[model samples]
Target: PSNNETEQHSSQVDQIEEEPVRYELPLRTNRDVPPKRYTPEKEARRSRYPMANIAKGNLSPEAQIFTTSLYFEEISTSVEQALESKV
Candidate 1:
């Protein structure tokens, strides 16, 4: 190729390389996990999820009792352990 054509091609390549591709990311509560964004479809789907309902304070009785039992069990076991170990 001619010098001018090669220089122009190199300049185009340089310009292309200088601009980095950026991707938009959704809101995240922490570094690892992205937060749940409520779209209409997701709202409908998550409505049937017990954990999701618990998050929204719409827990069913069974879920409430189970979660309460699990919570106290974990707390009594782990928290007491932590206190004992001075952790």
Candidate 2:
């Protein structure tokens, strides 16, 4: 009976060794702030107000609506000079 008990204990140890062990890792997530949601009403309200920031590009905001001869004068002069130089 003692020999049988020892055999049973050895078999139990063998069963435990045969099974695989697992390691679990914690999940990661984005910690940064979420972006603002877009709405048509908000865009409309923004469009109603004039932009405070400085205008970009060669042409001014006022001249953009009506492109007068002054804006193209520099371009035309440069082209005429280039043509004369070639001749």
Candidate 3:
């Protein structure tokens, strides 16, 4: 390598090294709001219907179990039919 080429390469590397790294951080909002204090009426209302607040979407446990059992029965019947046909 020539001396001029080596100096140019080193100068380019030094310029890259001298550049300051800048970090763009997201703006932070004030998140120190005080928690809400429950009144006596609110507390009583919450305690009154704890179960009602629970999320039991569409199918209940009994319905889910029945559906699962029916699915397995259908799969087993298909398997039995396939085996009988092979024999």
Best candidate, TM-score: 3
lDDT of 2: 0.64
- TM-score for every candidate vs. truth? 0.23, 0.22, 0.29
For residues 1-87, what per-residue lDDT tens digits would candidate 3 score against the true structure?
999999999999999889698898876664676656755565433476654454546779996677567656633358778787677
lDDT of 2 by residue, 14-87 (tens): 99889687787665564475655865565444554454442546668776655544444544358778787676
Indicate the TM-score of model 3. Answer: 0.29
**Over 4 Å off, model 1:** 30-87
lDDT of every predicted structure (CA atoms): 0.71, 0.64, 0.70
N/CA/C clash count, model 2: 0
- CA error at residue 66 for candidate 3, angstroms: 21
Off by over 4 Å in 2: 21-87
Clashing pairs in 2: none
Provide backbone clash counts, one per model. 0, 0, 0
